[model samples]
Target: MSLIRHAETSAPNIFHGAESDVGLSEWGHKQAGLLADHLASRGAEAVYCSALRRAVASATPIAHALGQSPVVIPELHERKIGPLSGRTRDEGWGVYEESKRRWIAGEVEFSHPGGESFADIDRRVRPILDDLSKRHKGGRFLVVVHGIVIRVALTSLLADRTPADFDAIAIDFASINDLVHDGSRWRAEALNLVVAPSPARPVA
Candidate 1:
């Protein structure tokens, strides 16, 4: 299966997190179209996405290209940033980054004030992905989701990697992280692969 970060958001600099429900930027829309075009030849049988607006918007074109409607999964949403929601990185006082640091250092319970812990995100997300892998078995599928979600999944699921590598892993907007299930464990095939040129601005 392929886990794709959603296209650039309408507010790329702000911390939209799970609560903010924003859509794509103008360039993001074009990026989504290019994403769809690129994935058209991949023969994905199903398309799944986070229920958040940005994820749904990103999946729309790809689902259309594959002649399937996107299955919305709430558990696949971005990690909730809680108090930092809607704030720019500078305005948020680096709380998010610090929380990530703690999480990577084996403090799975660490969280921003009112935000979810690494364990919280893992609990909600991993089961769904495992189930999807079982259901698809030998088939290919696509999941449009957030960068943090992708990063968390990679750190948790890949045996050679751990949360310590989370911050070092950069999941760019619309980039695809490909994984394969061997009827037992998940393995990475590719990661952070941007299929199309991205906008000049930095990603959220």
Candidate 2:
């Protein structure tokens, strides 16, 4: 299965958490189109996305390219940022970073004020991914989600890896990461694969 991060938003630097419903920016739409073109021939049998607008929009083009409708799963939404929802990095990053630090240091119970903890994300996300993997056991599918969701899910899916191990791995917008299920386990195939579009062409 291919796990994809949603394309950029209008305010790319802002913390648009699970409660925020922002859609794609102009460049984000172009990126989404490019992603669609890149995956059109990959023979994906289904497409899934978080219930958030950005994720839904990102999945639309790919789903169209594959001739399948996207299935929106609310449980796949990004970690709830709570009070940090619309704050820019400069305004609220400290609290967010500290929470992540605590999570990586084995403090899974720590959360930003009103936000979800690492354990909260793991509890809700893993079962859904497991079920989806089972449903598409012998086939490929697409799942459009957020960067943090991808990171948290990876930590849980891979036994050897931990949240700290993936701290340096950047999950860019519209990037594709592949996961393979071998009947009993899931493993990462490729990660952070990006498809850049031509600079001269304008997206209409």
Candidate 3:
């Protein structure tokens, strides 16, 4: 069996996207180190991350600790939110709600003005997952990615989950959700783990 977890990288300066692809915010950097320390303690190997800078940066320290470079997986990139990509969550209310409704209604092909639907991402991410499961059988892997991408991928891997499930799965910053692929089936190990803040760095 292989255990995989969806981990959200810490703060990355609020939707800067292509412009902010260089690295993390101050808090994000600290969070990444903390995540590394935590994963190192857990003895994790075969780390994976989105090619996007934030995710790569987040995975780096941990990969270094494990003596491996985080594998850059483009298929693990965040959902293409299109016109909504660069906007703050507050500014994208109308489009967000509408898209949520479409997803909830099972309209898989529904897309935003110039973006992708959950269906498109599910298609792109599935093959990568299938391959990972086969290649990394009986191991543990760390997958650091974006919020929506994590949710949609989880839904795709689990049986009978739909876009509505997306509404319920919350992926917070530096949070970890675990799943296990036992060759025959994939099972949820844990979901949405909020790491207790280290005493050395009080959360601001």
Candidate 4:
């Protein structure tokens, strides 16, 4: 399976977590097209993405290229970021870092009250993966999702890790994360690979 992050957003600031439904920026649309071109040859059986505008836009072209439609999966949405939503960059970044500190210590169950928790995310993610494995067995599928979701998924895959481990994964916009299921287990082949040239980045 291949996991792809949505292309750039209207506000491409760091630690911009838990953003509500928003569309991509001008360049972000271009990134989606480039991403489609890049994945057109991969022969994916189906495209799946979070039920958000950015994810839908990113998956649209890819789905078009594959002559298939994207399946919107709410379960794959970025963990509800709660108070982190729409915060200033520094403030949101601080909250994200602190949250990671907890996650790194293997506190996967931690989360904002009234928002989606990492443990809850794991609960939602497992069934999708299991379904994919059973239905698509050996088929290549693509998932367009959020950074936090991707990180939590990987963390869930680890057997028993120490502190600061899950924090190592970095997901950039329009990056590709590769996963393979070899009939028995899922293995991560690559994480956070950018397919198109990104625009000049603004300082965080």
lDDT values for all models: 0.89, 0.87, 0.69, 0.78
For candidate 3, the per-residue lDDT at 134 reads 70
lDDT of 3 by residue, 48-129 (tens): 8888887887788878988889888877777776676666667876787787788878887787777778888889877887
Q: Compared with the true structure, what per-residue lDDT tens digits does model 1 show for residues 34-113?
A: 88989998879899999999999999999999888999998899998888998996898578878888988999889978
Residues 53-146, model 2: lDDT tens digits: 9999999999999888899999999889898999999999898889878978888878978998888988998889888888987999889999
Each model's TM-score? 0.95, 0.94, 0.85, 0.89
Better of 3 and 4 by lDDT: 4
| lDDT (Cα, 0-100) at 90 in candidate 1 | 87
- The runs of at least 3 residues in candidate 3 whose Cα sits more than 4 Å from the true structure, single-residue gaps closed, are 1-22, 196-204
For all candidates, the clash counts are 0, 0, 0, 0
> Candidate 4 clashing pairs?
none
Whichever of 1 and 2 has more lDDT, that candidate is 1
User: Candidates sorted by TM-score, descending order?
Assistant: 1, 2, 4, 3
Which candidate would rank higher by TM-score, 1 or 2?
A: 1
Residues 1-204 of candidate 4: C-alpha lDDT, one tens digit per residue: 887889988877744444577789888888888889889987898999988888999999999989999999877787777777766687677667666777777777776554666777778886796787577887889989887777777666644423356778778788998887765667778778887746734322
Question: Candidate 1: where is the Cα deviation over 4 Å?
Answer: 200-204
Error of 1 at 48 (Å): 0.3
* Candidate 3 clashes between residue pairs 3 or more apart in a chain or in different chains: none
Checking candidate 1 for backbone clashes, the offending pairs are none
Return model 4's CA RMSD, one decimal. Answer: 3.3
